[model samples]
Target: MDRLSQEKPLKILVVTQYFWPENMRINNMVEGFVAKGHEVTVLTGQPNYPEGKIYADYRRDPAQFSNYHGAQIVRVPIFARGQRSLTLALNYLSFFASASTIGSYKLRGQSFDSIFVFGVSPIMVAIPGIVLGRLKKAPAFIWILDLWPESLRAVGVIKSPRLLGWAGKVVSWIYNRADYLLLQSRSFDESVKQYCTRAISEDRLVYFPSWAEDDFSGAAPVASDLLQRDDSVFTVLFAGNIGDAQDFPAIMEAVKAVKADLPVRWVIVGDGRASQWLARHVAEHRLDNVLLLGRHPLEKMPALFAVADALLVSLKTNEVFEKTIPGKVQAYLASSKPIIAMIDGEAAKVVANSGAGMVCGSGDALGLANIVRSMGALPATERERMGLLGRRYYFEHFSKAILFDRLEVLFRKATLRRSDK
Candidate 1:
């Protein structure tokens, strides 16, 4: 028999609104599957994310079909994610409508062993996977990165109890239909279990954590101007989306509190709705120590981390946020950089358990200032040791290779169970 025929390969269809070119974990997951001899296909929308406009090449003719690496990619029409709430809502709903209609027609004839939905925000993205799974007789698996209704409320996106109730029903419907539900944080177990019906057993629920990209392990060369750092000061860097959930106002307060006393610099590297506001705040306050470097490509992260004295992660105090771990935590750990977790609950626990760095309550400006001072006072050797511990913890638990292995087994189990049914 041919070597390729020695073992059967899996055919997986990934349903996600964001994919490659839109910095998402699903991109790495799909690439990993293709590397492991599994056939993969992605159904996603045009690449307009944090920035409300579509990318250059995709703008003119937004091709319906494309390929990345070895996996097939199917793109669908979607409204530009304009900053306004109406346009944003349309962007989300348009992807679902277009994907459902076009995806059904395009993928109906193709057979898949498993259908995987990567749910980051707006859980309705799973609809395509559920429909395709039923049509193709494949098991549908959902990896929940963000919980609905609760998340919407936490973000102040929807407030009315009646609206929340309807959203809750939609969530319950999706949960009931999915063959398997993978959660990123253990704290999410209870909330997710409450929605599980008699048809879905506890055994179908699995704790799945996101891991850092493989590229973050080592330093990569970056533009010198991108560094934008004072080599003498103790730098605390915050990288990723700067939004309401990040609780950047608290971070700004902390920076203001500490700048007068300590020789520390606060650097924020990313963009979002809050970017302009943050820039304005910094300008109005004339805070020279706080630098907003805007956004950079993913490839530059390693170099950026290499120069940083410590990495900062923060979230607003909310029940939903407490049960979630921000994806940047893994990247911070993988970079072998000491972290300063300014959040509560599960994420704080992860930093503490890993022996990576210090933690403070969310929105606690005074508490954050104190931790910054304490970390600044620590010896270089102590900080280096902490980074090493974080890196060790990452490889032992959250490395992509390890998590991907577990994911492959989960896919096989879901497929096997569906066949038995």
Candidate 2:
């Protein structure tokens, strides 16, 4: 029976605006499903991410389906990726419009067993998921990557109570219709269950954490020729997006507070709208401890992770952020580095449970600075032990192999139930 199952591949249709070569989890899900003996079909927009512009190779042909690695992709239309607030919304809406119109035709009447929708753009991609599932009679699984209306509300992007309620209804509708709901964090799972009135069974909701890439395996110890090494200086690196939600200003304030008492350096890597503003603020205040490196290539991240004595993970002080565990935390654990998290809620709980890192109160610059100073004071042996703990926790929990095994079960469970029905 096992051999027979292996011979017949499970067909999975994944709908998301982000996919491979984009370096996000939505891409990982498709590739992971394919690796587990599933034939995967992707409905996504042309690659336009942090830059907010269509990828150079894809601009001329926005509506094309190409094979990437083992997975098949159906690229839909989207407004170019950008920071222009309005363009981002329109870009999401465009993908929804295009995917809803073209997905069935693109699939050519292929009968997929399951449809997995990546829930980042909320209603934007939900339309395709709902429409395709109805057309194909496939069971739809919605991966709640982030909570929708609540996240938007926390960011102050959507303020009207009536508008929030309306958005909530739309989101709840999608959740209620989904056959399964996957959330990344425990806090997220709880919130998602409350937000959806659909009375989904506990079995239908699964907690699947994001993972470190296979390329991260056996990576060499962090070294940087570009970065000057100072034995007297302790470096704390914040690598990844320096966006509004990251609480970059708090990180800056913390670094500034410590500069007078200790020789600690804060390296802020990655680019975003907040990054430029951070640089300007650093210049205006003459902050010596803060170094803004902008964005670096993904290949160079390991070395950045290596050189730092400790990794800094932070988020704004808001209800939405409490449910999030930043993706970088996995990378930090993968690198076996000690972490100092300025995030409240779920991530802090993880840090405590793993014994891999320390967490201070949210947006507490003074607390952050004091912690940095204390961590710097620790002996090298003590720090190494903390890092080892983090790596061990990651290996046991967030490793790709472990994650994929759980997914295999999910796939079999999802398909077996459909077959039985």
Candidate 3:
């Protein structure tokens, strides 16, 4: 008799260490859920990213950080990931310890239709979501952004085989605990399934990818003084996290080779763990062409992309990295800018397939330098065409609206599998 009886909105609880006020795609995902008439709650740590201190504004007025896109924000005590390995480890542990016990206590009586976990670098964050799902009798959907033990090895964070094996066990436990594991790259299917080594059915592993935000498309071309524009020089923009996973050493090597012979300039806009290292490397080597503009707001990225001749996306050379697609690739495509990818595997395949830009093996400094020269040599018309093709590919495969509908279907399907245990 009532519409509520016929159809009802979902109540989603999101678990992650990062959220709004901290620039991550999880915020967009939350916004999508809330925009679709779903009630959402985010359980996350206090905002402190790129820069390892809690946001001054957040500390001054906590209330302002509580609500975003109509979703409630639940904060937990977490150690700031100060630019050090020990601090980073403590930060991860604190979030896990706090969220698993105190975070659960904070949401004591709350119920949810689904638990969405932002499965970022450290896989331990998913534990709290799994716990919540079990306690609340809700299906837990984990968005696996990075592979755990493998990622750790790739980043040179954990090298011991025994330790990696133990980390793998944790990943296996997480895989077995969750109702659904949504993968960002389809290439991750084999690794995810084989690594789990359990009877993780095909339906349990869904290929759900990151998409370009609306901000990326048709952004106003506001000019910035950061650009080193000239008629002869090729302006290549590299953005997002400047971390170990990005292979900055290889980039510095590439810059050395290109600067001596070619008219190329690399404008980097972002900050992360490796920023200081990168800055030092740039200074020590006199890589004058390498411009480090530190960090900028998300609102400024579109403008940066709008003005750049081309975009650059790269990752460290590792087997684990090959099975992933960096979120920036999608944004570069959506921004209609020709991309130059210094990455291997799936992300490289995406750039090559989309006719967006050139691709080369990861950590190949000479190869990267060559591509920069070649791209710079290409006619303006050719570059524009590449951008167009990339944008077309974005609409074809990674449309956000389409993916949102797919999520709805996944949520419904997950509910069906809730009793799989």
- Where is model 3 poorest over a 10-residue stretch in terms of lDDT? 1-10
lDDT of 1 by residue, 55-74 (tens): 87677655533777789998
User: How well does model 1 score by local distance difference test?
Assistant: 0.87
RMSD of each: 2.6, 2.3, 2.6
Model 1 spans with C-alpha error above 4 angstroms: 1-6, 60-65, 218-225
How far out, in Å, is residue 164 in model 3? 1.1
Give the top-scoring candidate (lDDT).
3
Candidate 2 C-alpha lDDT tens digits along 147-212: 888887887789999999999888888888888888878788777877779688899898987887
lDDT at residue 406 of model 3 (Cα atoms): 84
Error of 2 at 245 (Å): 1.8
lDDT (C-alpha) at residue 284 in model 2: 95
Give per-residue CA lDDT, model 3, range 307-338, as digits (tens): 78989999988898899899999999999999
* TM-score winner: 1
- Misplaced by over 4 Å in model 2 are 1-7, 60-65
How many clashing pairs does model 1 include?
Answer: 0
RMSD of 1: 2.6
Count clashes in each candidate, considering only residues at least 3 apart in sequence or on different chains: 0, 2, 0
